[model samples]
Target: MNILVMMKVTFSTEEEITIEQGEIVQEGISLILNPYDEYALEQAVQVKEVYGGEVTVLSVGPKRYEDTLRTALAMGADRMVLIDDPALMGDEWIVSQAISAFAKKERFDLIFGGQMSIDYASAQMGPRVAVELGIPIVTTILEFTMDGQCAVVHRDMDGYMEKLRVPLPALFTTQQGLNEPRYPTLQNRMRARKKPIVYYIGEDLDFSHEDRQVKTVSQEFFVAPRRSEGKILHGSLADQVKELCDFLRFAIQ
Candidate 1:
């Protein structure tokens, strides 16, 4: 089995985040592997351990993302690939295209990734990549088991569990109940430092100028405005009801 895990670096949720001029301030924020992606990486490593194969971690981000890839290496991935290029940076569509192009360069029996990154929470990358690769995909999977050349997975459908049997060369996006991610041991951490990361730029892949263009024309981020304090209605029940009615009428107007 050759497992491929799609990973991402994201701002740590524990860190204090602030928006300035409609953008996130990233001067001194902590960056780590996307929390949801950890489960996907752990599951891939465990699959490699049981099936006697190699786990490769892949990501498309800036150079600072190398740290997150090294962390995945320490977690038991055999190889790392980073698609780093300023021109390739865009919306999820462009990132998925880059990842799919990389996936085409290698053969993988299974692909694992988080259901969504914590920051954007768009939950579109994995599925988009799957579509680009023309492969079957199971999203928000809670359980996965291999049988012969197929995989049986359990996914959460609202409050119910839906079981599915998918063939090999499929992609899976993991949900929280998948498994606990293990921390890298000191020995593995040391070994990870020695592992080399393979990098790819826009020129390395076949992309036209149109493909490199940003699909999204504009994006804005702003902190939500503070909510006004609630008003208290005093006096008798009828008085309170009258005040509430008046307030509602005024608000509607």
Candidate 2:
């Protein structure tokens, strides 16, 4: 099994977000692997361990993202690919195009990624890549098992579990409950520091001008206003209901 895990570097959720002049302040914020992508990478490594194959991690971001890629390698991936190109960086549409281009050149039996990136939360990268590759895809999968050349997966569908059997050469986006990620050992971390990471520039990929065009015009960031304290109603049930209605009406007005 040749598995490719798509990963991303995102802002750490533990840090506080600050906006200055409609832009996020990134001077002192920490960056880590996308939380959801950790599950995808863990699943890929486990599959490789059981089936005896290689796992490769792929990401598209600036050179700073190499640190996150190194962490993925320590976790169990064999190698990494970093597509570091300013022209190729854009919205999800353009990023997916770049990923699909690279994936099209390589052969992978299975492609895995998170249900959504923590930063964007668009939930479009995996499916978009699958669409570009003309492969089958199942999102938000909680459980996955191999059945010969097919894969059986369990997903939540409107509070009900839906079982699916997909053929090989497909894509799957992992959800939160898929599996717990493993920590890297001291030996693996040492080995990861020596692993090779291939870099790709925009000129190397096959992309037209239209494909590189960014669809998003502008984005703004602002802090949410503090919520007001709740008010208590001291009276009978009818009076409380009347007071609540009146309060709501006044607020709306």
lDDT of 1 by residue, 81-138 (tens): 8989987777888888888888888899999999999998999999999998999999
Best model number under TM-score: 2
Clashing pairs in 1: none
lDDT of 2 by residue, 112-179 (tens): 99999887799999999999999999999999999999999999999999999999899999989999
Model 2 collision count: 0
Residue 177's lDDT within candidate 2 is 97
What candidate 2 gets wrong by more than 4 Å, as runs, is 233-245
Judged by lDDT against the true structure, how good is candidate 2?
0.91
Off by over 4 Å in 1: 229-253
